[model samples]
Target: MNGDNRIHLVRDEIRRVSACDHATLDAVAELLGTREINVLAGRLGMVAAHMASRAGIAEGMPPPGTFPGAGNERIDLAAQWNAVTVAGWFVRKKLTAWWWHDVLFDGVLVTYELVKAFVTAVVDDDPSHITRLTLRLRALSAGRLVIEVHDSPENAHLISAADNLISPQVEHVAHHCGRHEHQGRTVLWCELARPELSRWI
Candidate 1:
């Protein structure tokens, strides 16, 4: 790009723009290739995670206490569950709706099927729907896994204990389905009680 073709900075932009000249921009572009540019911010190109780390943050996350609930411990179910080929494939296909599991649950036949049914009911397993599910071992409960399905606001209206949605009346397993306040959102919660779950562990 020619110097004449470069964008002219306005007064406000000049203030917000990081102190860097064309040579610096050219060096950044050459060193990083396509990754380094924030044209709108008028700043030097920096990888997001690296920038966060430099700011005393971790992997694009603000430091603890930077936000209202940043201190709470939250596990990334995807890191483990998505490693399973089938689960990863499913996530990739939908792009929005995702089925997940935490370290506690082995996600066997019954558990996996039930969780899938609950999520599919709300999102119909469609890629456009933003519904997602997470399964974790219920605290202070023996052989019980809690499945929380967080629905998109637009689709939460479809959450139900309908027979077609969740086979709650089944003979094999007795489960509880209800809504609970989780982080200010009404989460579709289900408890899967399987005493034999400990066998896998």
Candidate 2:
């Protein structure tokens, strides 16, 4: 998909994760200007995989170190798995919010949900609630892909199994956001290197 469409799909996944029921889904789908259930589900799947990976990694179930094969197929499969995990976390939350259906807690829960989505999309590895995610960008040869994810003080105890996947020359920063107050809001950030935004001559 094109960047714009891919971005919309990402946003739709977020909305789908936020809704409570069929009617709510319909409303959100309408707001997003699409009725394709498969597309919505694709987005959701992506999210689920990430959330699952996050939880699993945190609990000691590790993600695969090597993707088995080389070339585009392997890359596509990784992307597919990543997308599904990322999407699943949100959908699971949607189901819960549907069950509880509380308005007062909606804002807080939903914000955490969004934060999860944001981190999953960019972290280049499993989601660990124990750590705050921040981002950094690095320069490499044109058309190359490099991603690195690490754990900080807040998440040091919960080791990520994806560290082995990191390529050389890809820099990462790990620091704890440790239950600290930031301008009246709790903050967690990961220093991520944005390879997608790199330029080549």
Candidate 3:
């Protein structure tokens, strides 16, 4: 069969098995090929993110947090979740549209969950303590995507707790995970390997 037909078949199968048990999905993904599954997952992630954005806007919520230079800055659980979800969609879309041609589909999902856990931990630990949160994404040299979450330097303990909360989750989808201090800001980061891009070229 031609490449396009094969891709269509694979995507249909992926959709069919997406709601099945994890083992079933894994088996089908293995049979269909990881690259094809990753592409499908990326597309699905974008769809999910778009739905989430529309839902938030429809509910009359403000856009996550103020962007840099917006004069007002605040970060809370709702804002953090919104930012990470939107960022995941943007990153995945950019990969599909640009030179990368590969997306960290599983990684994006894990990062969203991890970000939620991180935000919850902080709020539970001290509801009023965290005032600033920043998330940054960058492509690493070795075909990896790095997501860096930054917050107040004094909240080192909260960062550590978040690291512990998502350590196992991060391991499943990411190659590296750590916490550090950068220019006096506390940072938590995870590096996920991008799927091979040769097929799209």
Candidate 4:
């Protein structure tokens, strides 16, 4: 990606983060004036790396290796999600003035935060959640970024009630949506488009 593409991705991410953070669209508009896309993108990327490192340390996992090189980028989706997840937590508890009300009404943000907190707490307890966490990121982008995470049956009987719990919101994500179960793993995935941006792939 060129500088322009980077800027576009960063700006879109910032807008999305702003949304997930419960910043009113108006508040994001306010930010547009003072923040340059490149600077914000750099900060976003750094924030993600920092949070991912913290999550890894909390889990007692070894830190990831440095990037092979900048051009070798393959979309560190886990870290991206980590960044957004941590941001969601911060936005809800630290940044927003209406945290209490928004937590109830902002379903997308709520679910995202739930997944983050759940994943963080589980990773803190055991290492197994790392695999599921990686899988969740892949499933998120496999076809179109449509993805879901629920508790395993052993941990929580989530699969049986997934549809009733999430269908109303996720129905539009894919025509063929369902759960996939493995020995100790379960995931609900769908196809979702990356939100269109003016630049980059």
CA deviation > 4 Å runs, candidate 2? 1-19, 35-41, 64-201
Residue 7 accuracy (lDDT) in model 1: 41
Best model per TM-score = 3
TM-score-best of 2 and 4: 4
Model 4 RMSD to the real structure? 16.5
> Candidate 3: worst 10 consecutive residues by lDDT?
65-74
Whole-model lDDT values for every prediction: 0.37, 0.33, 0.55, 0.40
lDDT per residue for candidate 3 within 76-137, as digits (tens), equals: 32334465676566556654554554545664665575566567666777775544456555
TM-score of each: 0.32, 0.24, 0.47, 0.28
Give the clashing pairs for model 3: none
Please write out the lDDT profile of model 1 over residues 1-201, one tens digit for every residue.
Answer: 555445444434544544768887677667553433444222322222222323322232112121121111112232122323444333233222222333123333333444455555554535464544443322212223344334345444554432344344322443444444433444444444444422211
Q: List the residue pairs that clash in candidate 4.
A: 140-145, 144-192
- For TM-score, candidate 1 versus 3, the one ahead is 3
Q: By descending TM-score, how would the candidates be arranged?
A: 3, 1, 4, 2
Deviating ranges (above 4 Å) for candidate 1: 1-107, 123-129, 142-144, 160-163, 168-171, 175-201
* RMSD, every candidate, angstroms: 19.2, 19.5, 16.7, 16.5
Per-residue lDDT value at 67 in model 1: 17
| Per-residue lDDT over 1-201 for candidate 2, one digit per residue giving the tens place of the 0 to 100 score | 899999999778767666668787677677663446666665455445433333333322222222112111111112223443443344335435433222213322332332343344334444333234332111111211112222344433323322222212111222111122223332222212112432231
